[model samples]
Target: MRIAVTGSSGLIGSALVRSLLRDRHEVVRLVRRPSRAEDEVEWDPKRQYVDAAGLAGCDAVVHLAGAGVGDHRWTEAYKKEIRDSRVLGTAAVAEAVASLGTPPRVLLCGSAIGYYGDTGERAIDESAPPGDGFLADVCQEWEAAAAPAVEAGIRTVHARTGLVVSQKGGAWGRLFPVFKLGLGGRLGSGRQYWSFISLADQVAALRHILVTEELTGPVNLTAPEPVTNREVTAVMGKVLHRPTLMTVPPPALRVALGEFAQDALSSQRVIPRKLLDSGFAFEHPTVEDAVRAALRP
Candidate 1:
């Protein structure tokens, strides 16, 4: 299979690219930067243009191009960046795909569990109604932005991901130093439910979607079990052989992350119903086991 992947340099994208390459599939990257050697293709998403001819023969396109959600402060300005990067980039990719004389069969675009917003202790799945808040709105629009491809008779799978965990980078890398120094603990009230997935499971789930013709629309790329903030802290503590003695309250996060603090503090109990029903196996189903596998340094 010849796969066209955007955001091929980021944490998840890079890993997925490697996995696809290992399977002897040709991987072409749709880069915002200049295309390098081989099957690389250049695209200017902000201007909303792509070389239709370049993407003509690809079997699938895994669209992961977007701004880092947790990278910038959630101010009005940064929020626009978040929205534009996803909505615009996704629209651009879909448009490009639509314009293709022979479009790809499958499109695995990135979405998030944030689409369910803060569900408190209530377990939400693909059947649940859309929730509120900034992240939720962004996620809603992000997935909606892929309508063109779906309308064009393509199998579009929205990978509604959760807190993607990896030891090499992402949310875990920032905590490694603190946990290694025995200073880690729960965030906010510590009871907020956290929906997370290890990098291995995330990539595998994506691969599963690429081949599964029956699956489409908001596939939760998360583990079977979702944990609380306290659970995550305990898991990390157990992995590092340290005691989670202190708790960082919500106010502290507010001070540290501004408006974005509420996002981390929000309780989102999301489940992988679609994936499970469709028979996607998770390598790390428990947060503790996933943490141990990731924190193996």
Candidate 2:
């Protein structure tokens, strides 16, 4: 199959591209700058533009380009950056896909588990209603931006992903070194639940959604088992053979992360019910499995 993917340089996108290529599928990468190669297509999300011609004949399109949520302190400007990047980027990709004479069968738009803000110990699935807070609003707008593709009769799927368990990037990337240095511990009270997925499973789930015609709308991309922050801390120490005795209070996190701290300390026990019901299997089903997978060469 021929697939076009934005955010091809990002952690999840890069891995998905590699996996597709390994299976001999043709891949087109949408870039922000000028097209530099045969498989390159230029897109400007801020301008809401994409080279529609380059996207012709693609069997599917995965829109994952967006600003990293934790990459910056939650200044007002950065918050706008986060919302605009996803909403605008999705609109561009969806509009471009919708304009195609023969649009791709599937359009997978990136989303986040943050859509369910501060779920505490409550388990959430795609059927759950939207929660409150900054990220929930951003996520709602982000997914809604893909309406063009949906209106075009394309099979649109929202990948509401959780914290990926990979050392390559995301929150886990920062945790590895700290834990390796024996400074890792729980954040805040450590009672908050953390829904996480190994990098391999994340890529696989994306592929699953691409091919599964029956699946549409919002789908949670978390593991079957969700662990608490305290549990994650224990697993990290066990996997790294380090001590996990430190703790960062909520006030400290707020001081350090600004508005983002509330999210950092928030609890979300997300479940991949749709993915599981669609017969998607996880290679790393447990937090320990995820931690060990992240450490693998």
Best by TM-score: 2
Model 2: CA > 4 A from native: none
Cα displacement (angstroms), candidate 2, residue 3, comes to: 0.3
Task: Compose the digit string of candidate 1's lDDT tens values, residues 1-297.
Answer: 999999999999999999999999999988776778778888987887676677889999999988887787788888998999899989989988988889999988999988988899998889998899998999999999999999999989899999877777766767767887888888977899999999889999999999999998889888889999888888888888987787788888898889888888899888999899988888899988788778665
Per-model CA lDDT versus the true structure? 0.88, 0.95
1-297 in candidate 2: lDDT tens per residue?
999999999999999999999999999999999999999999999999999999999999999999999999988999999999999999999999999999999999999999999998988898899999999999999999999999999999999999999999999999999999999999998999999999999999999999999899999999999999999999999999999999999998899899999999999999999999999999999999999998989
- Candidate 1 yields a Cα-based lDDT of 0.88
Clashes of each: 0, 0
Once all C-alphas are superposed, what RMSD does model 2 give against the true structure?
Answer: 0.6
Please, what is the TM-score per model? Answer: 0.97, 0.99
Cα deviation of 12, candidate 1, in Å: 0.3
On the 0 to 100 scale, the lDDT of residue 66 in model 1 is 85
